[model samples]
Every structure is written in structure tokens, then in C-alpha cells.
Target: MADRIISGRTHDAYMTVRDHIADGWAASVCTVPKDAPKGEELIKLDTVFEREDVAWKSVERFARAELNNLK
Candidate 1:
């Protein structure tokens, strides 16, 4: 299967964990890009197989650490 944008969260320098919580992807692990900074842990989100937009909204509401990760 192709790599999907499971998570789309932004960390403020660092965050403990980032994962997908939709379409059976809630427990899926997030693999950041190779270029991602070491200290910068991105919030990993799993997009629905064919409903990416819907999945995004779920995660965006799940976390509210201050930073608008959706934007």
C-alpha cells in the first residue's frame, strides 16, 4: 500500500507521542520524514483510506496543545 499522511500534527519543539486515531489507524505508529529534525517530534496522524479530509478533522480536535496543527 502507498504511504498515506496518517498524522498532521505540529510540535512545539518536542512532544512525547504522535499517532493516528481514525479508521482503525488510531494505534498506527507515525513515521516522520527523513529530513525531520531530531528534537522536533511531529504529531503523526493517520488519514482514512479514502476519507482523508474527515480523518484530519478528528485529530485536529483530539489535541489542543495551543498550536493550530491543522493550519
Candidate 2:
């Protein structure tokens, strides 16, 4: 199966999405704290963003969860 990651704005939302997906798949969510250091890696919500960029961000988050053993 094609691997994928899905996310949301909050932990509750993230769990909701995770529950909605198929069985046997893992989920990870990225949460950039409000106090995150100012850097290019931090996603800025000051304006709209590229759709693909957001998609990749979620993928990154999911990978992090796996690396951190959240999955």
C-alpha cells in the first residue's frame, strides 16, 4: 500500500483523523509550538501556503512520530 500521513491543527483533531483512517497504518502529527524559534523550517501562517508544501509538512510530522516511536 502507498504510505501516507494525515494531520490536523490540534491533538484532538489529529487523533480524530488517525481514527478515521484504515487499520494497519500508522499516524504521526507535527505540532509547532507557539514559541518555536524563528527559522525557515517553521511554517509561517502569516499568509497562504502552497498546498504541496503543507502535504510534505504532514509527511515530515508522521515520519517524526515513527522515529520517536509514537507509532
Candidate 3:
């Protein structure tokens, strides 16, 4: 099946994967404090959900849940 999602740092490789998907996909990242200092051209982990704990797992899960809604 064609990959419909790309979850990782919004770097060159990540952006490339999203660009290749015909149906497009969601991208995500995990970071302490918060995501990238300056937003790029895709999803921002911190913006996906709001919580006191900025754990990687929490942000990851929240991002996945949001992507699942696209299905």
C-alpha cells in the first residue's frame, strides 16, 4: 500500500516522503519544551495538543490520533 503518512523531523527526507505521496500525508516530530523554534511547512507537534507534560510519547500519540481522523 502507498504510504499515506510521514512522521518524523521535518527535514529534507521527511519533506521528500510527503511530496511523493499521491494522496498526501501528515508529518510529526518529538521535542522537549516544544517543536521547532520556527515553524516550517507542515504539522507542529506542540500545536496538535496542549498539555503540561511535553513528553515525546504524548506528542507522538496526539499527532497519530489527529492523522487517523483523515481516514
Better of 1 and 2 by lDDT: 1
Q: List the residue pairs that clash in candidate 1.
A: 6-45, 6-46, 6-47, 7-44, 7-45, 7-46, 20-26, 21-26
Would you list the C-alpha lDDT of every candidate in the order shown?
Answer: 0.38, 0.34, 0.35
Residues 5-71, model 2: lDDT tens digits:
3333321112111222433233333343333432322322122223444544655654456434422
Tens digit per residue, CA lDDT, model 3, 1-71: 22223343332211111222343332344222224332343534423223223333454465555444444
TM values, all candidates:
0.27, 0.28, 0.30
Give the best candidate by TM-score: 3
Top model by lDDT, which number?
1
Tens digits of per-residue lDDT, candidate 1, 2-71, equal 3233333543222222234543333122334444754444445434333444444554444332234444
Candidate 1: regions farther than 4 A off: 1-50, 65-71
Full candidate order by TM-score, most accurate first: 3, 2, 1
Candidate 2 steric clashes: 0
Q: What is the alpha-carbon lDDT of model 2 when measured against the actual structure?
A: 0.34
Candidate 3 TM-score versus the reference: 0.30
Residue pairs in candidate 3 whose N, alpha carbon or C atoms collide under 3 angstroms: none
**For every candidate structure, what is the RMSD over all alpha carbons to the true structure, in angstroms?**
8.6, 12.9, 14.6
Comparing 1 and 2 on TM-score, the stronger one: 2
